[model samples]
Target: MIRGDDGIRAFFAGLARDWRGWRGVRKWDTIEHDLAIKARHTGRKIRLNFTLRPGSDRDYWIVTLEMVIPPDESLDRLARDIGELFGDL
Candidate 1:
């Protein structure tokens, strides 16, 4: 599990890096068009928003990732990549 400010920053940075490589076509209905509109834009960077909340038990954390995806990016592919990154959790 990630701890400290540096780790959190690194995690977000990694997500940003991965965002650039997201390509290919997805069904129009599956694409989150509203997310792109809500994305935080600062200079040339498009930042995705997320929240980390405490879980019911002390041993866990709930991470909610809000993505800003292009129309062409596949939701299924993104889900697969996330699964690979976080394993079965």
Candidate 2:
């Protein structure tokens, strides 16, 4: 399981890099695009739930991510980055 804010950022950064590479392929239409990440914050923690389906006939790839946030840390930048990432899609 991914832990901490850095892990979360790295995960999304890697995903975005790979996604950009995939977009360059001519057969990109064949790639599965059904991906969703729902983030919920409760108290000092955040839970990120991810659902991805590789194909219409395939089962979903589900993941639950929980991160502990230090009181001094702010999530505004992370939220913006996530919004921009999804906006690109």
Candidate 3:
């Protein structure tokens, strides 16, 4: 969850429902990952991913917000890794 940006939550909620995102019903841990994402649509769909690294509260969070595309190869991997790990909990 990125702070100071309600837009991210408002956007991703459009693509999928709140419950699904909240539950994070998919399993990405079959691979190695650690991330939490809340995505939504503006003029375009945006997925905000946060990777909170350990041993450094100063650099704890990293956010990646990408515009939606038909072939979003880069975003997919980023999202996947993040989802498998953090996932809003």
Off by over 4 Å in 2: 1-33, 60-73, 86-89
TM-score quality measure for candidate 3: 0.25
Residue 11 lDDT in candidate 2: 47
**Residue pairs with clashing backbones, model 1:** none
Candidate 2 lDDT for residue 47 = 46
| Per-candidate RMSD, Å | 12.9, 13.2, 11.2
lDDT, candidate 2, residue 18? Answer: 36
- Runs in model 1 deviating more than 4 A are 1-49, 55-66
Better of 1 and 3 by lDDT: 1
Clashes of each: 0, 0, 7
lDDT of 3 by residue, 1-89 (tens): 33343333333333344322332322211112333443443333333433433324536665544444322444455445545444554
Residue 12 in model 1: lDDT:
34
TM-score of each: 0.25, 0.39, 0.25
Give the per-residue lDDT of model 2 (tens digit) for 1-89.
22223243444444333332222111111124444454444444444455555556555554434454332224445544755555534
Minimal lDDT window, size 10, model 3: 23-32
